[model samples]
Target: MPEHIDKLSISVVVPVYNGGKTIGRAIEHLLRQSLPPAEIIVVDDGSTDQTANILRSFGSRITALSKANGGPASARNEGVRVANGSLIAFTDSDCFPEEDWLKELVKGFHSLEIGGVGGTVRAASGGLIGEYVDLHGWMNPQCARDGSVLYLVTANACFRSDLLFQVNLFDERFRKAGGEDTELSVRLRSFGYEFVFVESAIVRHLHRRTIRDYLKNIANHGEGQFILETLWPQQRWKANRRKEIVRSAAGLGTMLRFYRSYRRQYDRKRAFVFSLLDHCQYMARIWGYLRGKRELSSSSLRNPLTRDPSAVVYPNENLGSSSVLVPKV
Candidate 1:
C-alpha cells in the first residue's frame, strides 16, 4: 500500500433492498476486511422483509438508514450523502468481498488523476445460471482498448468521495441498478478522469439462480442502455431496423456455435438448453429496450442533460422522515 493510502479514509457503502437473505453475510465479510474501512454504511431501500431487523441486529457496527422504496441509485445516493470517508467503496448487498478486497481496491489509486478503481466479481456459488453468467462475463467491468476501465460495476468499485459529489453522486432518474453506474462513469470520463481495473481485488457475488431472474436482469440492462442513449443522443448508435432483423437471424448460427462449444464441458442436452437460453437473453434485452423507449416517451421526466451536476440536490440530503441510526462507537 502507498503512504497516501493511510491518509485516505475509506468508507464502504452498501445499498440493499429485500436483501434479508444475504445482507447479514455481506456485512460480516465487510467487517472482517483486512484493511478495515473508517465506516460501513448500509442503506435499506425500504425493504419489506426482515432486512431491517437484520440491519438492526448489527447494532453499532454499521450506520443504518431507512428510506422509502427508491431504487438502488437513490439508495446509493443517500449513502453517499452521509458517508464520512474521503473514498467511497460500493458493493451490492448480495456480494461478499475477500478479506483483502479493500486493500487491493485502494492500491489502484496510485495517481491523483485516477477517479475510481474497480475489481472483479466471481460467482459465490455454483448453479446453472451462475455458470452461464460467469461464462458470459456479464458482471465484469468494461474496459477500453488501452486497458483503462470504461465503466466500473458498482458491485465491486471504489471512487474518490469528492469526485462522486462533483458528478452529483448518481442520477436519480436511473431508478434501476444497471445503468446508473455506467452513466456516472461516462460523466466522470467526460471531465477527463480515468478509472483503473484492479484484477486482484475480488468479490464473490450471489448470482440470480433462476432463468426468470437472469432474464429480468438482462432486460433491465437493455432499459439502462436506452436511458444512456437518451442522456447522450450523440452517443446513440444508429438503429437500423432491417440490419437488426438480419443480425437476429444470424444469431441463430452463433447460438449453434455456442452449443458446440458448451458440449465440450456439458452433456448434449444441457449444452443445447444453455445455447437456447443465450438466444432468449438477447430477445429479453430487445423487449426491455422497447419497453424503456415506451416508458420514457410516455412519462414526464425531464431531460437529464438539463440538470446541472454541481447544483443537483439528492433526496436523502434532507432526511425528512427517514430513520437514521448513527454507528455506535
Candidate 2:
C-alpha cells in the first residue's frame, strides 16, 4: 500500500492568455479543491485583455507570473519552472475543476508506480459542437497496455514533477493546443511511464460551441497530428501504407458497423443525425492532417533553419517563423 495522501505535496498551474472572462471562475473553483495545492500559479502569456487586472484581484491567494505571450506549452513550462510541489498539476484557465478533483486524482498515487494522472473532462455548455463532443467521448479515458491511461491532456492532467522533466516538458513549438500534450504523452509512454485515468477527478470544459470555433479546433488538431507524424515517422499512418483495392466496399462495411454501434447507443433518428455531423468533423480532421503534411514539407524546404544541428523547427509545428524547440534529435 502507498503512504497516506497527506504525505504528498501538489501544486496547480493555470496558464492564461486573454482569459479575462473565465480566469476568475477557474481560480475560484481551484481554491475550493478538497486537497488544496501547495500554491496556485497562473502565468499570463501576453494577454491584451483585462486578464492581468482580474488576476491581481486574487492578490496573495495565488502566484501570478507575467511573460510575453508564448503558446500554452511555453506558458505551462514556465508555471512548472516556478512550482515547488512534488506534482505539477495543470488546467486551462477556461476549465473549472470539481471541489473533489484533486482528492480523487491523488488517490491514484496509491498504486505507487503511476507517474501521471488524467481526469474526466465534461462539457459545461450544451452548444451543438459541445454536446456532440460530450457524447462522442472526447475526454473519455483510454486504458494503456499496463492497465493505466494511454494519454493525458494538459487540460486536466497532473504529472510527477520529475517525470515531466524526464519527457522534456511540453513541446513549445506547438503554438497551438492539440499536439503538444499528446506529443509529451507519446514520449513518456515510450519511456514506459504509467499514467492512470481517474474517473472521479472531473473538470468541466467550455468547449467551442459554434461551427466556426469547432472547425478551427478540429483543424488545429489535424495540424498537430501531422506534426506528430512528421516527427515520428514510425507513427505516420501514411508511412505504413497498404493497398486496399475495394475502397468503396470497405467504406460501406465500416459505415454499416458504425451505424449498428450508434443504433445500440441511441435512437436511430438521433444516431443518424449526429453520425452525419461526426463524419463531417472526421473529414475535416483528414483534410487538416493532409494539409499539415503538405505544409510541413513546404516549410521544411522553405525554412532551412530547421535543419540546424543545434535546434529544430519543432518537427511539424509549421508555424512558419514563430517558435522552435531545442531538441538533440
Task: Give each prediction's root-mean-square deviation over alpha carbons.
Answer: 7.2, 7.5
Q: How far out, in Å, is residue 329 in model 1? A: 47
Off by over 4 Å in 1: 1-3, 238-246, 249-254, 264-266, 298-329
- Give the whole-model CA lDDT for all candidates, comma-separated: 0.82, 0.74
lDDT of 2 by residue, 241-261 (tens): 322312322355545555677
Q: Candidate 1's error at 264, in angstroms? A: 4.7
What TM-score, over all chains together, does every model reach? 0.88, 0.80
Q: Kindly report which residue pairs in candidate 2 clash with one another.
A: 45-69
Residue-level lDDT of model 1, residues 1-329, one tens digit each, is: 44555577799999999999999999999999999999999999999999999999999999999999879999999999999887899999999999999999989888666879999889999877777777766677887787778899999999888777666788877787778888888877776778988989999999988888888988888788788878866446566853663465357886887799889999987798788777777787777778889887634334553256344422222112212112111
Choose the strongest candidate by TM-score.
1
- Model 2 TM-score on a 0 to 1 scale: 0.80
